[model samples]
Target: MVKFLLLALAFGLVHAYAELEGTWYTTAIAADNVDTIEEEGPLRLYVRELTCSKGCNKLGVTFYVNANGQCSKTTVTGYMQEDGKYRTQFEGDDRFKPVHATPDNIVFISQNVDRAGRTTNLIFVVGKGQPLTPEQYEKLEEFAKEQNIPTENIRNVLATDTCPE
Candidate 1:
C-alpha cells in the first residue's frame, strides 16, 4: 500500500506540471532598484503548475535573461506551496523569495526578491497571440541594442527569429 501511494503521488505531480505547461507573455518588466525596461527580447512565459484553489496547487517557472542578445539562466525553476505563496526559497537559495497572484487565473504576477533583498516582479499572461512582425522585431532589436537588452535570452519565447504569420 505504501509503494502504491508513492507511485500515485508521483503521477499526480506529473499531471500537475502537465496542466501548467504552456506559453505565457508580458509587455512590461520591472525590478527593484533597477530601471524599468519597457521592451526587451521575446516574451515567452514557460510555466508548469499543479492543482488549484483560486491558484495553483504547485507552480514552477523557468525563464532566461537577455545579455546582449545572449541567453542565461537567471531564474531557476520554483513552485508555490499548498498555501499559495511564492515567498520562499527556490533552488535552495534563500536570497530569492517569490510570491505570485493566482495559478487558476489567466493572468498572474511572480514576485521575487533578489540577493540584495530588492523585490523584482515578473508579470505573466497566457497565450501567444502572434509572433512579432519583421518591422516590429527590428524596431525591438534597435530598442534592445539601445537598452543593451539581450535577444538570445528570449529565443525560446520568440520560437522563431522572424514572425510566424
Candidate 2:
C-alpha cells in the first residue's frame, strides 16, 4: 500500500510539472537586493518559455535580459530534487520553487547564492500575454512582505522599454 501511494504521489508531481510547460510572460520580479533587479542586473529576467521533460524531472527556462540597451536570450536548465525544488546554476547557484502554477499563471520564488556567498531572494510572477491582475498584485505584495523584500524592489518588466515584445 505504501509503495502504491508513493507511486501515485510521483505521478501527481509529474503531471503538475507538465501543466507548467509552454509560453509565458514576465509580469513582475521582486528581489531582496534592489541592485539585483535593477538595470543590467543578473536577476532582472523576462521569461519567454518554460519546458519540462517527459518525466518532469528536468525543467528549462528561456528568458531575456537587458544589457547595454540590448535584449539577450538565455536558457537555463534545472533538475528537480526530492524536495520538489528545482536547482540550477545561472549567475549563481539557484534553487527555485513554484509556489503557484496553473494553466494561465505561475509564481516562482528562488534563492540564489553567488560565488561570493551573497544570498538574494527572488520572486517571479508570470502569466500568458496578459499582465497581472489587481488581485495577483496584492498577493505579490503580501509575499514580498513575508519574504522581507522591500516594496520598492518590485519591478514591472513589461513597463520597461528595453525588452522586446
Candidate 3:
C-alpha cells in the first residue's frame, strides 16, 4: 500500500516474473475468513516453490496442505490472463495476482471460489533463502489492513510445525 519504500517498490514491479520464480517458504497469510485458513482448513497452504515459464504466461505452484493431521503436496499450473491474473483450478476455481516481489520475498492476493460457490480472499507472503524479517512481517500486517482484512487474521505459518520439511 505504499506505506513503506520496500512495499512500494514491490507493488510497482509485480510484472517482473523473473524475481518471482524460485523456492519459497510460507511466511504469513491474512484472510477475510479465518476458518478458511485455520488448522486443517482447505486453504491452509504452505508454498514450496513457484516456477514461471513461457515468458511469464504460465505459473506453476507447488505447495503443501495439512488435512487430517497429514501433509500433502499439490501442484497447480495457472495461465496468466491479459488482466495479469493467473487462473487455475485447485480446490476450486482459483485466481491470484502477484502484488509484490523482492529479491527474497513475494506476495500474492488470491481469490478462490469453492465448489459451494463460496469466495475467499487471501493475502499470502512467501520468503526465500531465509525467514521473513520483523519489519517485513509488520509490512504484511499493514498491507492486510489496507485490504480490509483484519491484522488479527494474519497467521504466521512459520510459527507452526504442522507442515512437513
Candidate 4:
C-alpha cells in the first residue's frame, strides 16, 4: 500500500503537496534566503519525487541556487503536518521557521529558534507576477516584527525581484 501511494506521487498520478512544490523565486536580500548569489535569479524550491514515506509522506524541499550560470541544489526535509502545512528551514537555517506558503507564493519568517535575537522575513513570488496579496502582508506582520525586521522590508524583499522576460 505504501509503495502504491508513493508510486502515485512519483508518476505524477498524485500531487502530494501541489501547493508546496515549485520554483519559488525572490530578490529578498536579507541574511537567510537565497541572497548568497545575487546575479543569478530568485531562490527556488522544487519537490523531490521520492523522499520518505509515512501517513502524510515526507516531502523533500530542494533549494536551487544559480551562481555564474551554474545551478547547485540541496535537499531539505519538508515535514507536512496533519493540517496540510509544511515546516522546513530556509536553506538549513533554523532561524527561519516553518514555510508559510500558498500555491502562488510563500511567506517565510526568520527568528532564532532559541529566541535569543534576530528576525527576518523572506517572502517569494512563487510564480511569475504572483506577489503576496495585501492580506498576506498583514498576516505576517507580527512575524516580521518578532524577527526584529521592519514590515516594510518584507514588502521590499518580495518586490525587489522580477522575473526576466
Q: Could you tell me every candidate's TM-score relative to the true structure?
A: 0.40, 0.89, 0.86, 0.43
lDDT of 4 by residue, 1-165 (tens): 999988876766234344544455552333243333235533332212224345435656554555456556666665655655445665333333335444555554433222333333443323334455567556556665665555554433334333232
Candidate scoring better on TM-score of 3 and 4: 3
**Higher-lDDT candidate of 1 and 3:** 3
How much is the lDDT of residue 50 in candidate 3? Answer: 91
RMSD (Cα, Å) of model 2: 2.0
Task: Give the per-residue lDDT digits (tens) of candidate 1, residues 20-81.
Answer: 55544332232222332223332332332223333343344545544355544443434455
- Estimate, for each residue in 1-73, the C-alpha lDDT of model 2 and write its tens digit: 9999999999898888787899888888999988988878888888888998858678899999888888999
TM-score, predicted candidate 4 vs. hidden true structure: 0.43
User: Clashes in model 3: which pairs?
Assistant: none
Off by over 4 Å in 2: 1-8, 161-165
Candidates arranged by TM-score, highest first: 2, 3, 4, 1
- lDDT-best of 1 and 4: 4
- Steric clash pairs (candidate 2): none
Clashes of each: 7, 0, 0, 1
What are the per-residue Cα lDDT tens digits for candidate 3 across 34-83?
A: 89987778888889889988877899999999888899999999999888
Ranking the candidates on lDDT from highest down gives 2, 3, 4, 1
